[model samples]
Target: MQSIERAFDLLELMADAGGEVALSELAETSGLPLPTIHRIMRTLVSSGYARQQPSRRYSLGPRLIRLGETASRSLGSWARPYLAELTEATGETSNMAVLDGDQVVYVAQVPSQHSMRMFTEVGRRVDAHATAVGKAVLADLAADSVAQLLERSGMRAQTERTITSVGAMQDELARIREQGYAVDDGEREVGVRCYAVALPGAPAGAAISISGPEGRMTRMSTDTLVPLMQRLAEKLAAELRTASHGA
Candidate 1:
């Protein structure tokens, strides 16, 4: 058990180092002796979970991407029923999204029954700066990390209401953290509004949202829907924890 823990600890250290690191860096960060880390990293590389770069830096390998994608698919399948419930309860389109790299990708969705409802294409990737689910996921991330991500992604305006400035987006994320939910008031689309909450303990960068027309999705409606999203997010988080441990 101790050995297994050490292996996982080293893997996490690599991930925290942006999925790549020199052996010496891992030794310094993990406080594990060089020989011990060397053996563990050899095991990881032989098992196809890590690869030694030409520079002698080890990086997370391609095999992990397959494992991650499979796990993400399973998680999306497990989350659909709950999203359906949210859609049914609120009469709005419910969505499940995961942050991949710098984009928010919709994985699962339950469209509203209404003819005029919002519908986000599943598998569609959108810049995190212009959407509610993106904001919700970003809200829980450290301010500096968020800043770094936005700096890389370049907050392009999807609509006139989209947050085009880092400072404004930072202020909004602060409010989201305090309020426990995030909102997009026609920021991504001219006529749409969305309410989102992060799924703590779920897949990394996962968030859920409900969206509808601005006219129907009013302030009073948001007050009610936000709590509903919070409740569902907690339930989903618990389910995700169970699934993770089982996996």
Candidate 2:
């Protein structure tokens, strides 16, 4: 049991370090002896759960992909009821997404009962630069890391409102960090608006959002919706953490 705990702790440390870490860095962060960390890492590497990089850093291995993907699928299944609750509360579309690679993927959604509503299909992938969920996920990251991500993704103008410059994206992300939420005002799709809050402990780069047509998702609606989004996101994060720990 102790070994299990230590191994999981080391994995968490690696995840927090962006899926890679040096042995000395892990020792420092985990307060584990160098030898112990070394032994555990060796076990992990041999078991194909960790990979030794050419630079000698330990990176999360490909073997974890199946586990993560499976878990994400399960998460989506359990999140539908919460999303349905959000839709009921807001009378707008509710969505859950996670940052997968350089794109954000919608994992779950609940449509509003209104004749006019928002729709983003589950499993749909969009560049992180043009979506509210994307910005909410990326907002807390270091500016330099965000810059690199944008450079790699190439922030094309999905619509005229899509932030097309690194400087502008940085400014918007800063605003999101300040407000603890992100808004997309027709950036991804014209006449659509969305408000999103990050799920801090839900999953890697997970967020929940409420979206509707601009005529309905106005500033007045934002005042009400953002708060609800935050609360629900918090509840969702707590549930996800509990589930993860049990797993």
Candidate 3:
């Protein structure tokens, strides 16, 4: 059990370090003795759970892709009911997304009942700078960390309103933090608007969003949706916590 815990901890540390790190850096960050970390890393590398790069740094391995995909599916399943409830309440499409490296991956969605509706298929990956859910996830990170991530994933403007400058993104994130939510007004796609809030205490960097046509998703609607979104986020977070403990 101890060995398993140590291995998982190292894997999480590697992910937090942008998916790659040297042994010395891991040791410094984990405060684990060099020999223990070395042994664990060797086991991981041998098991195909980690890869030793040419730079002698360790990175998350491809074998974890299957596990990640399975976990994402499970998370999506757990989120469906909440998203359905959100869509029912707001009469707009709702989605759950998680930050994967520098991108946001949509895991689940409940479309609005309206004939004209927004749809972002599950498993679609989008740049973090152009989506409300992405901003909600990024707003929790440090400024330097956010910059490092954006440097790795270039800020390409998806639409005219998409934030393309790092400074502008920083300002946007600051506003998100201040407002306790993020909004994407025709940033990811023209004529669509989205509002999102981060799931507090989620196992990963997760957020939930509501989206619809610009005409319907107005400031007045925002005053109603934001509070409901926040309440649902809190409820989901609490349920996740309970499930983790029960497990």
* lDDT by residue for model 3 (22-108), tens: 999999989999999999999999999999999999999989989989988988888889999999998889999999877899999
lDDT tens digits, residues 1-247, model 2? 9888998899877875667789999999899999999999999999889999999999998888788678668878877888998888878899999887667889888999999998888878899999999999989678887887788788989998999999999999989999889999999999999989999766577999889999888844566777887888888888888977897
Q: Which one wins on TM-score?
A: 3
Give the range where candidate 1 is weakest over 10 consecutive residues by summed lDDT.
Answer: 217-226
Per-residue lDDT of 77 in model 1: 90
Model 1, 88-141: lDDT tens digits are 888889999988767888888999999999887877889998999999999988
For candidate 1, give the lDDT: 0.87
Error of 1 at 39 (Å): 4.5
- List candidate 2 stretches off by more than 4 Å: 1-69
| Pairs of residues clashing in candidate 3 | none
Judged by whole-model lDDT over C-alpha atoms, candidate 2 comes out at: 0.87
- CA shift of 114, model 3, Å: 2.4
lDDT score at residue 82, model 2, on the 0-100 scale: 81
The predicted structure with the larger TM-score, 1 or 2, is 1
Q: Which ten residues in a row have the lowest lDDT in candidate 3?
A: 217-226
Off by over 4 Å in 3: none
Error of model 1, residue 9, in angstroms: 4.2
